[model samples]
Target: MNQRRLFIASCVALIATAMSFAIRGDIMGQVQQELSLTDVQVGWILGAAFWGFGLSILFGGPLCDLLGMGTIMRLAAAGHIVGALLTIVSTNFTVFFLSTVVVGIANGLVEAAINPLIATIYAGNKTAKLTTLHAWFPGGIVIGGVLAFLMTQVGFGWKAKVLTLLVPSVIYFVMFMGQRFPATEREAAGVPFGDMFKELARPLFVLVWFCMILTAGTELGAGSWIPTIFNRVTQSATQAGILQVVWINMVMYLMRQFGHNVSHKIAPTGLIAVSALVAAVGLYLFSHATTVTAAFLWAGVFAVGIAFWWPTMLGITSERFPRSGALGLAVIGATGSFATALSGPVMGWISETHGTAQVLPIWSGLPLLLIVIFGAIYMVDKGKGGYKAEKIA
Candidate 1:
């Protein structure tokens, strides 16, 4: 498949996943309220999606490599459809949670398949392209959240709001159906899958794999909780606009779209270090913002710093350790995305007991730590043989 087509497919995939947030967060909140859920049950209602998304991804990436992207995508999409239906009919929190698990399975499959697809398609500049692809994630969130808000104002029922997401799901499924399937690196390089399997446990692969874990954990952990933190800080949903994820996401999106060129020209490590620093400062400023507009600017600044971390790390991993394949991404995702899964209740507890305002700078310190880790890796790898300093995978 062509890069352009791959980009379009990625955008659609993001839109689908982003819409799930609406169903699980805003729309599901309405559902839970109508059903009179306890606060703990409501937390389960929202957190189930991420839990499912993370746990399923542990298996999904390797499975995608084994079964092929087409098969994985189709199966996951089916799960999504089923989950969506289950959500519409669910009467209690347990049923709602189970439905979201199905949706989460679908999300995990999407990440596993789509991340590698973008990497394979833009093999020469994976970081920039990957960043561009991930940008759609937050971009989709903005669109979905805004749409949900409008639908609420206009009296659109919550069930219909969820089912509407089906339109894009079907369309993307069709897109995948018609397009020629892309090959994994194993396929492209004519390496046997057995050989790829043997390489997975090598020391270099392990190093890259661990970094992927920490990198993903750092990025997703903080990113996932900020919105809820926003809720706690702002004191109401209408005031919730004061701490929008969209600001963070949009900055991330733009940086990713352009980050590839900047990354390739400059040192990836330097770029990452600088971006992280810039982001830390942004978050620090965010802690101090007293009003919505100030929070927006700081959030955007924080987004700028975060924008390049994941794709660049992936680029670094794949380029430095080309043999690891989808399993590499899967491992890191398992650890980090799961960390995101745990962060919700943890943050909730901290907010409940410690006052929500205290969570900001503490979380902000995390990315600052990332700058150190990434910088050290950059120093170690710099000027190595045939490891051209400025090139990206």
Candidate 2:
């Protein structure tokens, strides 16, 4: 198999996955206005993507081992195409909500297939490669966010904004077609399904699973609201608010690209533990910013805190629990997205009842809690000979 071709195809697929998020987030206020939806309703609509993503990934994990990653990638592309079309034509709350769900499902499939696919092809370098592959996620967000900001400046409506999702979706679909895929690492190693299931019961896996909930929610939940929250907090231009989304993701893109350097110095859990403290500080300060300059400054801090989180979590699982395979990845990913799904509504209700400024400060608490959890884990690992990846036996 052409590892370069497959890896590039996987990155393109993730770009499409991330575009949906950036576009959806950038266009959210327009959607709310066009549909005459309440903040809570809009929250639910946005949350649907995570819900669809979580459920699809929950299924897509085992299916990767059963049906093949190629099939899952094909389905993801098709879903993105169909979901984009549905979103373009959607005029009401119900249609918009359902369309977002389709996009979410496509996003989930991308996670389900590609995490294991990268793990399989780069078996010896799973963590660094996975981190590099996931860098495209923020790179795609920068693409989508910049496009949305430009379209808004040119007086384009939300429908035109929605169309941008199709570009990457189609590109990835074409790229993935006719390319063969490798078996997942677990399968290649001949790890049984029973062994994969057994890994879930390990205490460390359980702790990581719970931590995924906080990490994913902290990163994704705040991301979905960045445009809207900054608009209210800075009382800035609509277009400028979208630019803040672009700015934060730009920071994330750069940080993730160089993350391997940081990883060489720190274990994943230790890195994430530090990320939690930094994220909490950044979020708290960002919530208090009243000027665009101040908002941009603090958003950078928040980006650095979350930049390594999602991929590093996947890397830790892949390295430390190699026997668990695709099913394990699905579980970690699904749990994170599901937690993110709930965060949308919770944040929305908070924004509705309290105010937009309160959202991030309250959201900061997730990472604060994670600081304690991951710090403890890191200390335990230090006591156990300074953290080594477990081998597949």
Candidate 3:
């Protein structure tokens, strides 16, 4: 296998995933206004992406073993292309919702394939490499955010913004066309399928699984709302709101590039604990911002807080539950998505019933709770000779 080529391809696929998130969020207010939908209805449409991602990754995990990572990658590309087109042509709520789900599924498939792919290819440096690979997530967000802002400034419609996603989607799909993919780390180690499932029941895995829900919700739920929330909070131009999303992601991209050094000094669990505390404060401060300057300042804190949450969560799980293979990764990823999906509508309701400013404060509680859970986990790991990856044997 050409590891360099595959890794590059994986990064591009992730770029597609991240772009969808940024663009979709940037255009959400336009969609709501154009469709004449209520806040609750808009929330459901937004949540579709997460729930769809949750379901696909849930099934795609074991299927990766059965089908092959290459095949899963192909399907992910197709989903991105199809979903993007569907979204572009969507005229009603049902079509838009289903199209978003397709996009979500595509995003989920990218994780199902690439998470294990990175773990397999860079087995010696799983956490750091995965962190570096995921830096493109924010990288893609920056790309998409900037594009959306520019397009909006140029008087482009929301459909034009959505169409831009197809560029990376096609690029990744063509790149993966003839490339060879390695077996998952578990498969290469000759771990049995049943043994992989057995890892799911382990106490550590179970605890992390539960924590995944909160961490994901804390990171993505608030992120998904940033554009709309900031728009409402500052009563500023739409570009300002999108720029806030771009700014936070820019901080995230830079931080994740240096994530390996941090991983060496702090266990993944410890990192998560600190991230939770910072995120809570950042998010709370952001919820109260009355000016674009204040919004950007607080968003920088929120960005650093969430930068490591997703990739590190996956990294620790892959390390500690080597036997669980892709399933363990998928389970935790799916949990995060589903939790975010559930929270989306609730966030909308909170915004509608209370105010847009109220949403982040409510979500800030998620990470506060995470600080307690991950802090305890960090202490336990420290007692056990610090955090270490398990061997498959």
Summed backbone clashes in each candidate are 0, 0, 0
Q: In model 3, which regions exceed 4 Å deviation?
A: 28-44, 89-95, 237-239, 349-358
Give candidates' CA RMSD values in order: 3.0, 2.4, 2.4
lDDT, candidate 1, equals 0.71
Residue 360 lDDT, candidate 3, scale 0-100: 86
- Estimate, for each residue in 183-301, the C-alpha lDDT of model 3 and write its tens digit: 89899889999998899999888888989888877787788788878777677755477677778889999999876568878888899999889999999998888777888899999
Residue 105: error of model 2 in Å? 1.4
C-alpha displacement of 242 in model 3, angstroms? 2.5
Stretches of candidate 1 above 4 Å error? 1-3, 190-219, 231-237, 241-243, 352-354, 385-393
CA lDDT of each prediction against the hidden true structure = 0.71, 0.88, 0.88
User: Over the stretch 1-393, how does candidate 2's per-residue lDDT look in tens digits?
Assistant: 888989988899988998898788778888888789998898688668778999999899999999999999999999999999999998889898989889999999999999999998888787788888999999998988788878988999999988888888898899888898988888887888789899999999998999998998889888778878877767776547667777888998898887656777898889999988888999899888877788889889999999999988999999999999999999998998888778877888999998878888888899988889889988988998887887776
The CA lDDT at 3 in model 2 is 89
Worst 10 residues of 3 by lDDT: 233-242
